[model samples]
Target: MAERGRDEESGKFTEEYPKEDFIKALKELESTGTTDIAESVGCDRRTAYLKLNILEEENKVESKKIGNVLLWELAVESV
Candidate 1:
């Protein structure tokens, strides 16, 4: 079974998404859907969504809709 907490095999570290990682993910994807963010961060999709919501609430991340997909990226102003 997939162990709870951090999944080291997938590079999902417990230390919240660092600015560097966030930047890398954003630069690589330009704009990314939720699934892509989860894969990039090595976390489950739901976890990624939760973290994104938290970041959004903190003004650290922003989201935009492209068609029906919602893309996410770090809020440059917050950085």
Candidate 2:
């Protein structure tokens, strides 16, 4: 398995799930929650949530709250 955090040589934090992988996961799903994205990307739910929010800020993805659930999907302009 890959190391959870930090790269030995670069001394920078490593991502268990790369942002590209996260985007790909989002593309595969129509609309899904963070837990589902995390499972698809093989990362933790927290990581998925944070990354998704970042994407939202970038306008790469959009989210909607349905009841207690937050569903995320890629932005139309992003596709």
Model 1 Cα lDDT, one tens digit per residue, 1-79: 6444676688675565554565577678877898998888777888778877777888878999999998997788854
Q: What TM-score do all the candidates reach, one by one?
A: 0.64, 0.82
Our model 2 lands, by Cα RMSD against the true structure, at 2.4
Q: After superposition, how far is residue 12 of candidate 1 from its true place, in Å?
A: 18
Q: Where is model 1 more than 4 Å wrong at Cα?
A: 1-24
Clashing pairs in 1: none
Q: How well does candidate 1 match the true structure in TM-score terms?
A: 0.64
Residue 7: error of model 2 in Å? 7.3
The TM-score leader among the candidates is 2
The superposed Cα distance between candidate 1 and the true structure at residue 73, in angstroms, equals: 1.5
Model 1, position 61, has a per-residue lDDT of: 82
Model 2: how far residue 1 lies from native, Å: 8.3
State each model's CA lDDT, in order: 0.76, 0.89
Query: Which residue pairs collide in model 2, if any?
Result: none
lDDT of 2 by residue, 1-79 (tens): 6556888999889876677887899889879999999999987899899999999999999999999999999999989
